[model samples]
Target: MFLQNVFTSYIFLVLGLFHVCHAQHITTSLEGRLAFPNKTPFNITTKITLNSGEYTTYSRKDGSFIIYDVPPGVHQLDIDSKAYHFGQIKIQLLEESMDSPKCLEYAYPGAPKRVVKYPLVIYAKGTYEYFETKKGVSIFGMLKNPMVLMMLFSVGMMVIMPKLMEGMDPEEKARMKQQMEAQKDPTQMFSQMFGELTGSSEDQTAAGTTRRERREQRRVKNQ
Candidate 1:
């Protein structure tokens, strides 16, 4: 019976030591909610950093926070907002657990206090945006079209014709100047142009007829 009593005492002594060690290792935690003025826990983000062990945590979407395993002592609680201005606060943690939520409220600066005002940003459609919507055809489609080739050829002629005239000999320049003067009278110019075309056609016909006649005469002599 004495041996059984001693065994029971040893078991109770071991359990007591376990309890004491668990209580000594108990850690403290901080819970809080951050909010902006006249708002219910805005979606703004908040950063909390405890100087001890450099522990840190960001606030939830509802502006709630829970920092675990905080060292129990006087520590600097550095607080920062992603969209507001609430400086830091010093926290004195003396308890193993804090169930009451720490509530913090901050206000944004007034419009007059805003020194760096950002300009309004906007996007405008370009003038050529409509052409882009046509799907490749409106932009480079003309490059492959016959009309574009004709237009380019006409423009090239217009550019080269003046340079050609400038480089002509003095006699050719005189002739060209006379032609320009003739062009001043549109009626006379059209009449003269038509006469020249008909005269050249007649001369070609006459030369072809003379050649045929010579061939006929040669055949007769051979026969």
Candidate 2:
């Protein structure tokens, strides 16, 4: 009985060590390539990361990269490039080295699985907007603003309509005058009745809308 108990204990110890050793050797290499648009300038310092900062690798001059000894599990593979942006991909690897690799959409996890070829073919989305665009208030940009356009329209109507009304007879001129006064600019009327719906003000609502505006939105849903 004593000899049998020793043998049983020895077996369990051996199995535990074997399991640990096997898990340690289960790592595989993650491979992928970085591609950019034709004639797009790219720096040679592009790097790839897995599971945030668990494992990191840099791409070669020819845009090829590999993360060595990646442990078998799910990982978020991402590229780090200053001038460009790349898609975040979800990669899953199993214990079997023969298990083929696939890229899944990391951003939309609940969406359908998007399986792509192994040795991932990563493409550039576009360049990052590093600097704020120069805002010197050009005539074209100001004209695009709702407030500016409304003001210009109201001024033009006030100036031109009065002189044009001079040619009309008394009844016609009075009718035209009433129509002009009654038909206030819809934009101006909304601003006065509800509140400022647009433009950048320091105390403006974070959503660019007020509680009343949201109620108005829900009201307009039937329309």
Candidate 3:
């Protein structure tokens, strides 16, 4: 019984260590083609650096390359070939497992080409991913989903509704604009809505009186 207990504890310890190691280390492939300054793809020698250290890989006949078994961290990669220009990128490793290899293409001047750059930053809490293309557009990959689209739609409606309603009569347009502005603050919106719903002219009169009294008080105080 004592030997069995010891074996069980040892097995558990080994399994725990394995799980921790699995969680800490990650492996992913980087696959992309290399192109010359003239926008022609060619076979190239690729060097990937992890954490500023020298790492090496090779591109296939089609100028495609893959780097596997990359640990979780920031990596600086360089791709070079005798026939093509050199390209460099910075990558962040965060996911426990990744299968989709990043694809990078080259761009040259005088010819419209797509240049892809992936710069990933990993934080303790999460990872931030961004990409820049030769077309002068930067994309944040994490926020490019449907939920963000819905949020943008809601905000667009909130901004455009007041302008659309402004085509009504002057008095109605002014009232709607005031209502929209008042909704910007929850406390002000609640107070105004309550006053309007209850037909409370007392609050309005009190507000006017308070303003006038404050002006008089300020004048007297200044005197």
TM-scores of the models, in the order given: 0.33, 0.55, 0.35
Measured with C-alpha atoms, the lDDT of residue 195 in candidate 1 is 59
If both were scored by lDDT, which would come out higher, candidate 1 or candidate 2? 2
Q: Best-fitting candidate, measured by TM-score?
A: 2
Output the worst ten-in-a-row residue range by lDDT, candidate 2: 200-209
Residue 5 of model 3 has an lDDT of: 100
Error in Å for residue 2 of model 2: 2.1
**Candidate 1, which segments miss by more than 4 Å at Cα?**
1-24, 96-223
Return the lDDT, model 2, position 120.
85
Displacement of the residue 32 alpha carbon in candidate 1, Å: 0.5
Among all windows of 10 consecutive residues in model 1, the one with the lowest summed lDDT is: 116-125
lDDT of 3 by residue, 1-223 (tens): 9999999999999999998988776566655455444544444344444445555676666556666667666666654433334434555556743543242332323444333543221111112245554554445754578898889888999898868886788656756766778878998889888888898845774676689889999999999
Q: Give per-model CA RMSD.
A: 17.6, 20.3, 23.1
- lDDT (10s digit) by residue, model 2, range 167-223: 998757755654455456776445433444445432443443466678899899967
* Residues 153-220 of candidate 1: C-alpha lDDT, one tens digit per residue: 87997788789898898657755665667778998678657757778635644675689889999999
Candidates sorted on lDDT, descending:
2, 1, 3
After the best TM-score superposition of candidate 1, give how far the Cα of residue 220 lies from its true spot, in angstroms. 99
